[model samples]
Target: QLHNFCSIELGSFYLDIIKDRLYTMPADSIGRRSAQTAMYHLLQALVRWLAPILSFTAEEIWQHAPASDDSIFLQTWYELPELSSAGALNDADWQRIIELRNWVSRELEVVRNKGEIGAALEARVELWLAPADYDLLQKLGEELRFVLITSDAEVYPLTEKPAEVAEEQLGVAIRVVPLEDAKCGRCWHRRADVGQSAEHPQLCGRCITNLGDGEQRHIA
Candidate 1:
């Protein structure tokens, strides 16, 4: 479980997925702030989990972590936040979403191996999803790209699956296409509105907004 939390949750999802938002965006950006806050909790929890197995190392980390003055011996297991009932995506929904995302990754991999795109964000993914999947993804709207880690993503209800792209597991038909737009210098995502700001020629509109009061973000 600890290995899974470290490899999948922290490495794959949190840090790797939103590396750009965490590093490139301004400190005050809501998305950046949200990522930082989540990381703080994760760090604290992980360190506590390590205390029993790696006592010396965990103690070292605890010194630099929050409540540094307190020793790790005094702390109990980190209590994770309970799943919220406030209209947030539950665990099951996220599991389903991960399955669908894996499907999309396979499609992107095929295109990437062919040298059509250098980065995952260099291509856009379009999905013809089952009714359930479409409804779940539509909740994210444009932010779905963040989850897919793609430059752009479009999800449509599956009317009829395409003959070329075959899939049965998730009932998703995926298409990967190279984006022709200029890539954002900061975010490195290809976007058509990249040069809109006169002051920041290489940034996307979202980055521009983030530079000021920060962009509102609910989920990655």
Candidate 2:
């Protein structure tokens, strides 16, 4: 089960989710810090899990881990964070958001494979979603772009499925369009306002925001 967890879930998460945030956000931004904290916690938990079987490797990992723990034997399972039920977005909402993101990702992959876009970041995505789903994603505001790993993402409230879509897939539809704007040298995301600023003409507007106060991301 753990092997499958690592191979499938964590595999998609690290590559498709965390990597985007880490690469784009500034060094000291809250988003980057959040990703780093998640990675650290995951490492500690995994090291504990492997202590009995891969004793030498677990011990080696423990040695270089953040805290000054003497040995793997001296540790307990990593304490998970307390779950919040009263938040604006709950666990169910996040699961739904993941489902929605998967649809966008598949469409982006199709666009990339067609040679119309070099990367997800080179295209803008438009998501047409059921009213509830649209409202749920809009709570993320602009952070939805980061989650989809697209240059820009636009969500529209929708009611009915198109003729080609299956009945079960009624709530979601995605369209990808290649972007022709200048690419940011730092983040590599193409944007129309990339060259608007003379001081740093090659960077996107978001990059400029990150340079000073950093982007405020509540959810992704």
**Among these predicted structures, which one has the highest lDDT?**
1
* Candidate 1 Cα outliers beyond 4 Å, as residue runs: 160-163, 168-170
**What RMSD value applies to candidate 1?**
1.9
Name the lDDT of candidate 2: 0.80
Task: Provide the clashing-pair count of each candidate structure.
Answer: 0, 0
- Supply the TM-score for candidate 1: 0.91
The digit string of per-residue lDDT tens for model 1 on 126-172 reads 89888999899998888889899999999877877667866545567
Residue 176 Cα positional deviation in candidate 1, in Å, after optimal superposition: 0.5
Candidate lDDT scores, in order, read 0.84, 0.80
Per-residue C-alpha lDDT of model 2 across residues 28-109, encoded as one tens digit per residue: 8898899888788888888889899889989998999997468998988889676556657876987787787777778878
For each candidate in turn, give its C-alpha RMSD to the true structure in angstroms. 1.9, 2.6
Model 2, runs deviating above 4 Å: 83-85, 160-168
Cα displacement (angstroms), candidate 1, residue 217, comes to 1.0
Error of 1 at 152 (Å): 0.3
Candidate 2 clash total?
0
